[model samples]
Target: MEEADSCRRAALEAVADVEPPRLHEYLDSILDRASMVPAVLTLESAAAMRTEGRVLEDADEPHRDGESEPDRNRTQAVSSDRDPARITTHAAGVQLIYEGLRLTRSLAHDEPWTATDAEASDADLGILAADILVARGFYLLARTDAADKAVRTVQSFGRDQTRREDLESGAETSAGTAVGIDGGDPASTDANLERDVLELAVRTGAVAVGETPSPRLHAVVAEFAADVGTSFPPVADCLTDLHARARELSLEDSTTDRATSATDP
Candidate 1:
């Protein structure tokens, strides 16, 4: 939870330097209106699965035994507290804000809406906030220790969000899963979007931690995402399952384990 708050503050700090206070206020209102607590909790949990308390170095640079990355670039400490991966989770959450603004005609912060004449202007501002957040989210990812993987994960995020937001059921997801965004006729019960976001978090953090995830680890994260996306009972149990499976595979190299209990009862 502390980690979440830290990342939340980091997110605010991301846009705090805007020259115009109005734009900054819009950004602030977006986060201020959204209950980012759950999203932050999931992000911190996934980030915790990564290497902890270790300073990251450029993968391009070689290191001796037991040596951290070369300290030539002493710019910032990406420790768990300021994890960009976790912060990206919140950045991606701007979509939720956009959804609220468009669907509810207000930010839902209980702000005065008497100025119905200002609806278009407010919507424009909200859209701008969402757009800035998307760019910021991708920017944060591109700055990670694993730039390639981080960027790809965010790309997948875009595709997944587009697939879900298309309002058309049975859209073929990039992963080849035909998930129904709406409940009218869900071809696949797997359209749980929470799992997709969390899985991306796990994969991004895994790469950031100097590890290539195994298929079992992927399956574990996917299952947890599925459980949480579908509102399965005891979602925390899903997270526990992910932690145990990830820990088990952590002890083995990428080649040893490929099968998992995903299909098990």
Candidate 2:
């Protein structure tokens, strides 16, 4: 349990420090390190359940509750051997979920737009943060109970749709009504959106950072977005847009890789 807690803390800190393109890399590293605890705990739990089943079957033969004390003791002995690891996994899972929450909060902590209105603000940061939180919640849900709870909490918070207020505020900010506008280009804005979504997807353990929509992934995103009263159409549209952008970026990356390789020779 202590080890798990330590892993969670370390993972959270690492993610907090990660920059845009590198966030997913940090998450992958942390998850790889922490993966062993749950795997071991799952095996131990399965073994205990099997043993408990046999003991229950034997106890049903002829004994009343009080008379099965000896059998109960034996069953407990076996159970005890499994308890520490199970506890450790549960604790670790909880800690990881908490870390996910912390990450989300940190991302949402500020305004989404920069003072210049050209880049992502602290609010936009929160949306990106929430995206990662939702994805991580899905990944961890398969391994831990705490992850399910985290998913529920995030679901309660609503989806990733751009609210009217947000759009209006953003437009105003970019137009220089708030602070002076930074005059960032459409390409930069699009790139930022793509980068943020891809970062979230990778952190959540999607197979690749480029375009490719798994139904399960879409379902997860839909659930998260449902809170904002976003219908499936817009959600689908957003996802398609992200995927298209990711594919374009991937092609660019591939071209760059080939060029670099060619140049090296």
Clashes of each: 1, 9
Root-mean-square deviation of every model: 8.9, 20.1
Which candidate ranks first by TM-score, i.e. highest?
1
lDDT of 2 by residue, 1-265 (tens): 4343444454454345446755555465545443332222222222222311133223234545575687676554434433444434333333344334434544443444544554465345545554563454355334432344445544433332222234445774565543212133322222222223322332222211112333433443334333322111222233444344434544554565567778895
True-structure lDDT of candidate 1: 0.48
C-alpha lDDT values of all predictions: 0.48, 0.38
Candidate 2 segments whose C-alpha is farther than 4 A from its true place: 1-6, 9-21, 24-86, 116-130, 143-148, 158-265
Model 1 bad stretches (over 4 Å)? 33-117, 145-193, 230-265
| Candidate 2 clash pair list | 111-121, 111-122, 111-123, 112-121, 112-122, 112-123, 112-124, 113-121, 159-225
TM-score of each: 0.53, 0.29
Put down candidate 1 lDDT per residue, 101-188, tens digits, no spaces. 2223223322434456587577657656666765565555555554454345445545544554443444354346544344433223
The deviation in Å at residue 183 for candidate 1 is 10
